[model samples]
Target: MELHSHRMTALVLLMAAVALAGCRPEAEVAGGALDATDGDPPATRTALDPAAASAPITLEDVMEFDPRYLIGISYPPGMERYPGLAAELRRYAEAARAELMAAVEDLGPSSEDRMRAPYDLALSFDLLMETPEIVAVQAGGSLYTGGAHGIPLVARFVWLPQRDEMLTAASLFQGREGWHEVSAFVRESLHTSLSQRLEADALAPADRFRLLASGGEMIDEGTAPEAGNFAQFEPVPGVDGRLRALRFVFPPYQVGPYSDGVQTVEVPSAVLLPHLSPEYRGLFAAG
Candidate 1:
């Protein structure tokens, strides 16, 4: 069976930025990685500055296996300047593409027949928040391979450009002790949000405590703040360009039913600052 082809349509701010800014496509390589002949783009080192207003890093769509399976990936421009980070992104994208393809193949002999029906598997990434210290990107999409409904997933990636590696909750907060504090804050925030929903009749009182308890249980099982329960996060930048609040993301079914959709809770700077390491605290301190 052959997959259908369609002209790519840019989605959301990241894609739109690439389109509007006239980001020229780099020479395509056989594999998913793009070559960086040009020196690292300035955007890689600094936050997106309105004064300069350079185009945001654009991703190229690689591993397109018909309409049934496709993977669109791109990293911070000039990522190639940092060989380690560039290699990591390539590995991640390729592994993700392979995993999705394997799932399609698992559909068996009926796979082709199933493809004839409406089916889609798409994965895309977007730059969520960027600062001199941390760059956060979100990878999310829906997969429908013959189910009652498509499965929606969202994962976050935090990059420390200076360190030339990815950031985890432990590393960011300096130790497990800080992570424990973060987890507690998340639980409190979740309970408060649920309570508000119940009061507003957005959620039935009968389901309120059960759902809240499930969310808390999931949080407790994770060793660190971002282990399993709170895998996605973005730092809200303050007016002064410092970290303001940390946003925790939960996909559908993590906190509530599929109909409830994705859930997010923001922990303000005041709440998170005291728990942060001196290193990270400096990143958010007012100038």
Candidate 2:
């Protein structure tokens, strides 16, 4: 989601400035543990001024868009009355359902719980799709006391089926008290899948080194109750105050646009560090 801020006074000043001068993207590179070359390359960084006194912010500093910012999951304004919204939502829902089905096919059914498993789940799947973003203008004043304007988190991309897919597991557990029987396995499977996928991306020796050499950025997209309360997200900054880093969900990579949902995607230090992985120590020396 994007927001535009204009102060009556600042707008006039900006106009005058723009009329006289042009703007440029800023670059400020510094030594840090999280180097740009080591992680997901960031988008362009444009700073107003490095010497100016103001809050320090970088492209990676964006906050997540969560449910707290939504007005409900339906169409926004004139759209509900507009002729195309319902059809559009239906289209997105169908696409999302197809994607989910593909994921289910990949996972297949678990040996024991055919009902709860993806291939043979007892309950049905329900998809939830949120409306896409639209133009917005604030008629009122600042949301914050300090004259800071607040932007409603707009839904940029949404393609969930608008239905929920739930599978009951009581029969599989044989009347077990809780999820203890399968929760851990499910978590492990997700973790393993995510790790392998990330590792596979770094197939080349240089690529492996690049990925494991540095710490990447992280973002906390706010929660959205309307979209089944799915968490929102933003990319984290690299050491150079740049918006450079891969922003993916952890674990269940099958369901996310960016991340798979596991906390960190990294090669074990033992695997990357020379002495830790004795067999690879000589390999590092050669490099």
Candidate 3:
């Protein structure tokens, strides 16, 4: 599940209100009013090349509202070759910018104490996998809004090149039953990982107790293999470059305190083959 930025949520609600009033905001390009700068320019290419494994997907900065907030957006250069997918990526970046701006507005005019330090907002995307069949991107970062700490988020976008469609967590499974099995596997993996962490001698007894208490909530089905909970995942590849396991990602505070940082666990494809739909089962099968 993706965490909607405050601004994105507000914008959606505002749009809905406008719709009820029979009006709408004029559409704008991806960058909107932000002053764009090539923060980390990617490699220049003459054409779309999905198979270009070494190609760079760089990030660009939108600093029009800097000192108040900052946003970084990017789209892989060759994405335009796939018009629909390119549009989706552009829209995603634009939405991220809207969220950052909305966050700044929600803070209102900064006061002297608030002005002591500038608010921070950042969004960036990374291409995690680029197999011929699928391409996966991870988009997320931290946002601070005059709080005790900033909230970090991570989301995954998997595109099926052959189908020219995006894959949701549910779509990757066989059916409702398949999802349930995957969810159970995720919960068990989390429990095992967390137990190992707690048993480590590095942590103080009090810290371990606190973690255990706070992390207990994560053990149930509610926090298990639902679409939202497992939004960020990737296929783990073996030495032969074949898919071996499915790795699920969990950002901090998702399953434990921030101090615990991000957590990840992988379930072997072999173990999940029975629960996978025919379409993906073959892809995950041993090479």
lDDT of each: 0.52, 0.24, 0.55
Model 2 misses residue 65 by how many Å?
18
Which has the higher TM-score value, candidate number 1 or candidate number 3?
3
The candidate scoring highest on lDDT is: 3
Residue pairs that clash (backbone atoms under 3 angstroms), model 1: none
Candidate 2 vs candidate 3: the TM-score winner is: 3
Model 1: how far is 138 from its true place, Å?
1.7
In the range 133-209, model 3's lDDT, one tens digit per residue, is 77766655555454454545355566777766666676777656666776777777777777787897579889988
User: What's the distance in Å from true for residue 12, model 1?
Assistant: 14
Candidate 1: RMSD over Cα atoms? 10.2
RMSD (Å) of each candidate, 1 decimal = 10.2, 24.3, 12.9
Candidate 1 lDDT (Cα, whole model)?
0.52
Cα lDDT of candidate 3 equals 0.55
* Backbone clash count, each prediction separately: 0, 31, 1
Candidate 1, run of 10 with poorest lDDT = 33-42
Best by TM-score: 3
Across residues 136-207, which tens digit of lDDT does each residue of candidate 2 receive?
111101111111222111111111122111111111122222223222333444345544766878678776
Against the true structure, candidate 3 reaches a TM-score of 0.68
